[model samples]
Target: MKTSLYNIFSWIRFTFLFVAVLMIWALRTLNWIWMRPNRLEKCLRKQGLNGNSYRLTIGVTKESAMIIKEAASKPITFSHDISARVLPSVHNAIKRYGKNCFMWIGTAPRIHITDPTLAKDVFSKYDDFQKYYKTNNPLVKLFIGGVISYEGKKWAKHRSIMNPAFHLDRLKHMLPAFHSSCSDMIRKWEKMVPEMESFELDVWPQFEALTADVISRTAFGSSYGQGTNIFELLKEQSHLTLQAMDSAIYIPGSRFLPTKWNKRMKEIHEQVQASIRSMVNARVEEMMDGGETNEDLLGVLLRYNLKETQQNGVGMTVDDVIAESKLFYFAGQETTSGLLTWTMIVLSKHHEWQDRAREEIFQVFGDRKPDYEGLSRLKIVTMIINEVLRLYPPVVELTRIVREETKLGELTIPAGVSIMVPTILIHNDHEIWGEDACEFNPERFSEGVSKATKGQVTFFPFGWGPRICIAQNFALLEVKMALALILPRFCFDLSPSYAHAPYVVITLQPQFGAHLTIHKIKH
Candidate 1:
């Protein structure tokens, strides 16, 4: 009787285990098949959005891929407007389906938010609407880490740690770094010119090098000299990341798959991390060896990190330091370069405004180097930069993913939806900026950005609300220094080869080049 009972119990256990496994598999299949699409469609209907009825499993992935492929194949043109090439598809969808519309890209439902009030709501509730796109592209993930990718407590902690580095006093101390970088650029340009005579050259690369130099000097101090080549490697890594995005949908563990591109990406990611790790280790050691705490950004950040570690005994790890350092390198370099390049392009086109800017620079400094105090006095120069940012924002679009069901304005945004706030569209909107919205006008920002947007959330070059860019002051200061040096030393005109194609590769950048004819200023 005992043997028979034990045999029956053993059989029961095996049967139960088999049933559980089958149930789990069924649920996973259902999630992929029915649940995801149903949720997406219901959310859109509730939000009063209209779009192509989502087809089975794949949804609109096939159509979206075709559009992206076409955009990629188009020949590069300097005169063609970037928005003109890409906005039609988006605009047509909105026109057909109304303002709050949904379009599928893979399994994701991209909800377009064009209304200023809706945008304001999305920007303000950033914690709820957070960045959620995860990819198999390793380099992209590493470079864009930190507060930009983080949400909730992680974001708050990182932001708190980084805030002190960009303080007003701290920026003032770093003015020399900016000056030194700009001075290097001017010297390079002077040598390129034939006996300092008029010549046409692409200014995009110059702006890039200047910003790279600034980030290197300010971020790593002596370490930048050692890590200069690594900066170039990081730039290459950025390009590879963009290429990786063009591939088909990536599943979990996709990077481990036996594809040549995947292997190359993995290698690059490893190399970048290795380089950053070495620099971070060296800096930590130098700080430990009785080195004076300098006021540069990296120095301040390291000192703060050390203090936090000592006090809490559970502070940021070496990996965290490396991640933040990469963030500083990419974000610091890209933003300043974009701002300076666009500002230069706009100032070149609008010669009268350029003259006013040069006049402001002359009146404020008079051929002398612009100090932090003197840069502040150049009101017209500041206005020109602000106007350029409004027209060609460094980040053309800001995205946030909804993790849980939330009400944005009157619409209920369901979980796993992407809210896209196109900064360029709003900035160039006729209703918002009047009839001459697209025109390059500095006077629009003369009274300040508040009046420029007509009290709406229209002008958000550095973003808006609680999650607004932390490095706005840092970027502005760098721009002020570069403009102060360039406007007084050289006059520039848009070259015939200059292209107006502004494409988004992490940041909005000239697709071809920013060609300009430069003539030395006569004293």
Candidate 2:
């Protein structure tokens, strides 16, 4: 009878413990989905920031996704005012809630910062407002989770190791690789076009291929074939990443599920990693044997990486090097491709700018290969590229998180709120940029970025402050080389089949394609 009583008591205790665990979980979830968001909402509202009250269901994430999809379905007329199509949801939010407002991305409130002073502050204070990589989809973490995703010490370490490769002197060594790739692409175009007739070709895919080839040559040198293969995998991986980020609703352990998209993404990730590792191992072996490092990015990186490991005794592992290489392929390829594609489209629209740029190219190089010094001297080409970047900046917005309570201008932002630095919006704001903000006038940047932004932190195509893109000079130099070669050889105008739909898939791209009538120039 005593034993039976003890068993009954044990069972009752177990039941009580289970119920307590269930209750705790329920409360935490309730806080996450409802109470916390509401509290953040109240905090922002109290600070005079306006926004729609946070909804417990999905917040505004689902609604914003739907709005973006609807906006991207149709093509906009040929005009430089692309913010409406590119960032429809954010654009509408700014219109409805004013510039000093917040929008919900899941439970988190993203505070829109339009003021240049506040933008500058947020950028300068990198530690306080660090990158927010918290995401629902794991694929995003797999692809872009490198130095760009890191903070504090790790970011500094990686940045230091990789900085030498992008130095102007090192980049000059890679100029030959750039020239070779551009020549190959232009040669292909020459073959396609008849003696003097125009050919309706898509420059978007053409530029994509050209940039990929350039990255292959400039990144891996002798391993160009392997580099090419890796980027092809990365390109597909980029698409799958966009699809994986379909909604904000995240189920715990959902990434482990054997969904088709998830499986393919994992496969591609492994393939890319293995490919990069193979190259790194081979290079390391060669380096240990006292082989001279080539001039490509890999050589410079490995050489610097060795120096770092020897001096600091703590350096990037093979895996770390692989991540940086992937970044080089992804960022280097995508940024230059987008910049060149847009420059062509914009120049085509405004033929006068094209004439001016071509004239400058001639005066600087005169049918000769464009050297770095001459490329730098091409002021008109520089202005056109800057204008293109301002109108269609590679990254539309920069996200930073407030892990602790932060102060921005007059507002005291609570912890867990996001800061949205919408570069596209600021770039196109008439109040800051005068009435013709949306128009594609390269003369706005005639003097330079400083004069264009009037010393404000408004024109950040590659970004601003310490965390600015490391490869900015590398990319601009390549673009100049391509233009220097092509501008004097051929002239292009938009094909009637072209649809002017600028949208973001990781970066801004033409929704349809950049179809143009390529006419060989008789010089």
Candidate 3:
């Protein structure tokens, strides 16, 4: 009996050992096949592109994180030129390496292209350099979770169906929502102030609230209170997502671990998705039941998508609608809020420009609500807004993925490479914008975008190419509308408490709140 038991134990041990060896071999083989960087890095190196040679697994990710964290820790002097502070890692890499270089994020090589001509190609050619997952950050993909994830025919269809919602005529309909939301915010500011005297207030939260309010009212015909809650949830999700990127290192299946952050992130996303889904389904049902057709984004999308389906036998699904609505919340809210915030701060500093804008606002509308034509005619105001966008763009950077081995310019970009299309870096490039690139000058955009770039296709505060922001008109209108109300009603200057540290938490924004001293205009 003892001899028989011993034989069985030996066989069991041998079987377990065999299975472990097989599993290890399979994992290593998969890693080598999918995550190895020898061939592409070698090609990039041969082409004279500089940067750290590719390392296994983490691959300069840890070093890059250290560079970023260190940069953030040591704040710079009060200045608008935040290219270094905003993108220190990239800046450092550019210094250490040449202009055209490559870094690694896991096994993926990030080919940093700073040349404007090549950068232009990156944006114009959608297929060769496409946007898959941003920097291979799964958390970003999880939060973005929108049509941006799609490619080829699907992407075209998605863009097609959603285009009508942001059309010129459609945006005209949203003006009332914008006006009403901004009015409520200013009214509260009026109440907060002691009759015409100046008072300090952090306009950051106010702008945040205002944008959320406008998105709520315009997107779903919901009140500020309701939209505030949903926007807040999304805001939290984005914060957590960016934090996860900072805290967690790149690894296979790292996000799925049952860590506290992972769990909380998953839960928050679930809640956001659920809330958006409910809104989408209700709107779709209302459309089907022939109820009052809401003209807000949700309603228009339903109607527009219905037509698309009827015409081409294809349209955004219920989930597709949901993703878009969330995108509307994310991009629409974040972009407008940041734009307005930085505009207010810059206008505060450039008090001369602030006065000029008010003069233009009153000259155009004279205390009346701004119409689209009138707003369009406010050149000074538009210049100031454009300058603010150039100085402090909402989105600091855009990126694309090299899906297949592709040739852009002189270099052959290999598959499994990522591209960085930095908006701020290019916007502030002295070479492109001349000596006063870093200065706050609104005259650059006076003649229009084409004339501003001298027909180079630069000044893409709203991005460039076919994938240019659909909400550009909408956002510009909102800023025009918001500033028109605020400027004529009150004059503001940067508060003593306000810090000028611009940072990036997904979008370029003032790290500290934008506190300002507001003085009412005596009639």
**Highest lDDT among the candidates is held by which one?**
2
Model 2 residue 82 CA deviation in Å: 0.8
Q: Pick the candidate with the highest TM-score.
A: 2
Tens-digit lDDT string for candidate 1 (376-429): 887898888888887788887787888888999888888878888878777777
State the C-alpha lDDT per candidate.
Answer: 0.78, 0.89, 0.83
| TM-score for predicted model 2 compared with the true structure | 0.98
Question: What local lDDT score does residue 179 receive in model 3, on the 0 to 100 scale?
Answer: 90
Error of 1 at 168 (Å): 1.4
Compare candidates 1 and 3 on TM-score and give the better one.
3
Predicted candidate 3 versus true structure: per-residue lDDT over 1-523, tens digit per residue? 9999999999999999999999999988667645467777778889888888777656477777777777777546766788888888777777789677778776677877778889889889998888755444565666876666677888888888788889999898899899999999999999987876999999888998898889888998898787666788888888887776664255668777898877877787788888889888888788788898899988888898999999988788888888889998988888889999999988888989999999988899995778888988999988988888888888787888887888998988877788987788788888899999999999888897778888775678887898888888989999999998988899998888887778888887778788999999887
How do the predictions measure up, each by TM-score?
Answer: 0.90, 0.98, 0.93
**Per-residue alpha-carbon lDDT of candidate 2 for residues 1-523, written as tens digits (9 for 90 to 100):** 9999999999999999999999999999999989999988888999899988788757478898889999999998899999889988889999999987889888889999999999999999999999975376767788987689889999999999999989999888888888998999999999997788899998988888888888888888753465667778888887777766656777778888898878888999999989889988999999999999877888888999899999999888889999998898899889999999999999888999898888888898875777888988999999999989999999998989999998898899899899999999999999999999999888898888898888999999898999999999999999999999999989889999999999988889998999999999875
Model 2 segments more than 4 A misplaced: 223-225
